[model samples]
Target: MKLIRYGEPGHERIGVQINEVNYDVSAFGGDYDESFFASNGLARLDEFVKANAGNLIAIAEEERIAAPFTRPSKIVCIGLNYKDHAEETGATIPAEPIIFMKSTTALAGPNDQVMIPRNSKKTDWEVEFGIVIGKKASYVDESEALNYVAGYVLHNDVSEREFQIERGGTWDKGKGCDTFAPMGPVLTTADEIPDINQVGLWLKVNGKLYQNGNTSNLIFSVPFIVSYVSQFMTLLPGDVISTGTPAGVGLGFNPPIYLQAGDIIELGADYLGTQRQEVIAFQKN
Candidate 1:
């Protein structure tokens, strides 16, 4: 199922896509958050959809589409997980995953504008595949990791190069800016995808193609990341694990390129859906 939430920024209603039309599931009484997915809510959601098949309300054409889930407990990111990307940045491949976190406040709907923080000029775009955990997972085995995944979504890991590399700290500062993580047009359940590893993923800035790559190029695959991350930190339902970006990032360019105001970023994965975000400079009151 392509589970979705749609409406204004903070008031999205839970829904699912059927025959390309959104079927309202708000009557199920909760946004698609951690609690909902953890308590076997997806099964209940499926039942509801089946029972109310013909009665479901069709979402209006004007309503906005928000991130599929609300309030995820964590947004963990893997850095330099792709071989081409690691080589482009001139960084050695890590023995293990390079993990980082983005604040939940950074989360926004797929089409939301990416607000460049005041005085910032290095904002960048990273198109990645995000994993949504289905249940509490700790000390999970790589072989069993995919079993705990509820679905996948398209994520833009917006970054600030100077703040990330020259500011003398973790990547969080460059990553956690508001609207930096534009999540989805929809969250596709695991059953919808047969092979998660080979999806075609790419991104564009303005109208030119920038990052063009496939998940098949990932050095450390999704299951490895989930199992590896869980050994140290427990992963809760609705927690997001972004599987890192591929090559062709602005940082990987000859002279390097960065986002400025009025830039448009668009990205998508094979089955997860597509999203577009406009970049706007921040203005203080």
Candidate 2:
């Protein structure tokens, strides 16, 4: 099932897409948050969809969408997990994952404008696969890591290169700006995907293809990342873990291109769905 949250920014209603139409399911009494996914609300939602199939309200085309899941406990990211990406950055592929955290407040809907922070001139784009946790996970074996994942979504790991590499102590400084993390068109359940590692992931800026790669090239697979992070911190339901991006990021270019106002970014993964966002510089008051 393709689950979505739509309405206004903070007033989104949980919904399910049925036959190309969005069925408003918010009346079932739960937000599409950790509690909903963790407590088997998806199953309950399925039952509700069946029982009220005829009466389900269809969402308007103009409705604003919020991120598919509500507030999450954490947003963990893996850096340089792609061999080619590591090589492009002149860094050695790590024997283990290079992890970082993005403040949850950076989260926004997929189509939202990427607000280029004040005095920033080096904003860049990274199209990546984001994993949504379905259960509390701690000290999990790599073998059982995928079991804790609820699904996957498209994520833009927007960055400010200057702050990230030149001016900062950590990558988080350039990463956690408001509206930097644009997630989803919808959250797809794991069962819908046939092979996670082989999914085709691609990105286009203003209709020009830039990042074109597949999960098959990832240095660390999804299951390994989930299990790897769980060893150090508890992975709770609704926590997001963004697997690293493959090559062809703006940072990997010969003069290094960066996002400017009016640029449009479109990206997606197989079975995860697609999303687009327009870039805009933040205006000072």
Candidate 3:
């Protein structure tokens, strides 16, 4: 099922997309967050849809779309999980998955304006396939990892090279800027996707292709990532794990290319849906 949250920021209401049409389901109550998923919200949503089909309110086609789920507990990411991406950044292949956390404040709607962080001149982009944890998992076996997954969403892991590299610290410094992580046209359930590892994904800057990659090239598979991470910390329902991006980031350019005000970013994955964002200079209130 294609689940969505729509309306103005902070006021979004739950909705469902069926046969390409969107219908409001807020009457059923609750935001799609950790508690919702922990209680089998997806299954309940399915039941709700079936029971209220004719009574469901239809959302206009042009209405704004928000992220399918609420702000997760944390946005975990795997760095250089793709060989091609590692090579492009002149980094060695990891013996184990590189893990980092993105601030929950970075979360934004898929089409929201991407504000270049203040004093930032080296902003970059990464198109990643994101996993949403459904069940609480700790010390989960790799073979059973998939069972804990709730669904998937397309993610743009925006970064600032200076803070991440030049400033000397974890990638978190560059990855957690407000509006940096624009995610979701929708969060599709795991069952909706035929093959989790075979999805094709791509990104473009101002209509020019920059990233063209697929999950097929990932060094660590989805099940392994989930299981690997669970060993370190409990993955709660609604927590997001971005599987990492393939080659062709701005940092991979010969002399390096970075995002500037007025640039447009378009990215997505198969079955996960697409997103578009316009770049703008940061404004301080």
Candidate 4:
């Protein structure tokens, strides 16, 4: 099922998309968040859809689409997991996955304007597949990791290269800016996608192709990442695990190409839906 949230930024209502038409499911009685995922809420939602198949309200065309889920406990990201991306960044294949965290405040609607942080000159984009955890997982085995996943979403891991690299700090410095992580048109359940590792993902800036790659190139794979991450820290329900990006990022270019005011970016993956963001300059208060 294609689960969604639509409305203003902080007041979005639960929705479900079927047969390409969106229907309001706010009657289901709760927001999509950590508690919902931890309690097998998807199954309940499935039942609700089945019982109210023809009675669900059709959402108005003007309503805005927000990120599919509420603010997660955290957003964990894996870097250099893609062989091509690792090679492009001139880094060796890591013996294990490289993990980082993006501040929860960075979450924004899929089609919202991307804010170029104040004093920023090296903002960039990364098209990646994201995992939504279903249950609390700690020290999980790779073989059992898939059982703890709720769904997947398309994510643009926007970055600031100078703050990430030249500033002499962790990548999180450049990655956690507000609106840097614009996710979803919808969150697709894991059952809907048969093989998560074989999907194709791509993105473009100003109508020009910048990232065109597939999950097949991931060096560590999803199961390994989830299991590996659980060993050190507990992964709470509704937390996002961005699986990293493939090559063709601005940082991978000869001279590099960063985002500027008025630039339009579009990106998507099969089954995960698409998103478009218009770029604008940051304004100081």
Residue 154 displacement (Å), model 4:
0.4
Any runs in candidate 3 off by more than 4 Å, and if so which? Answer: none
Model 4 agreement with the true structure over 1-285: per-residue lDDT tens digits:
989999998789999999778899999999999989988999999999999989999999778999999999999999998999999989898888999999999998889889999999999999999999999999999999999999999999999999998898688999999999999988999999989978999999999998899998998889999999999899999999999999999999989899999999999998998999999999663
Deviation of model 1 at 65, angstroms: 0.9
Question: In terms of TM-score, which candidate is stronger, 2 or 3?
Answer: 3
* CA RMSD, predictions in order: 1.0, 1.3, 0.9, 0.9
Give the per-residue lDDT of model 2 (tens digit) for 17-83: 7766777888899798878878987778889989997999999988887788897999999999999
Whose lDDT is higher: candidate 1's or candidate 3's? 3
> How far does residue 115 in candidate 1 sit from its true spot (Å)?
0.8
Q: How does candidate 3 score on lDDT? A: 0.94
Per-residue lDDT for 219 in model 3?
Answer: 99
TM-score of each: 0.98, 0.97, 0.98, 0.98
Ranking by lDDT: 3, 4, 1, 2
Which model, 1 or 2, shows the larger lDDT? 1
Residues 8-116, model 1: lDDT tens digits? 9767898999877887888888878888888998899999899888999999978999999997999999999999999999999989999999999999999988999
- In order, what lDDT does every prediction score? 0.91, 0.88, 0.94, 0.94
Displacement of the residue 11 alpha carbon in candidate 4, Å: 0.9
Task: Name the lDDT of candidate 1.
Answer: 0.91
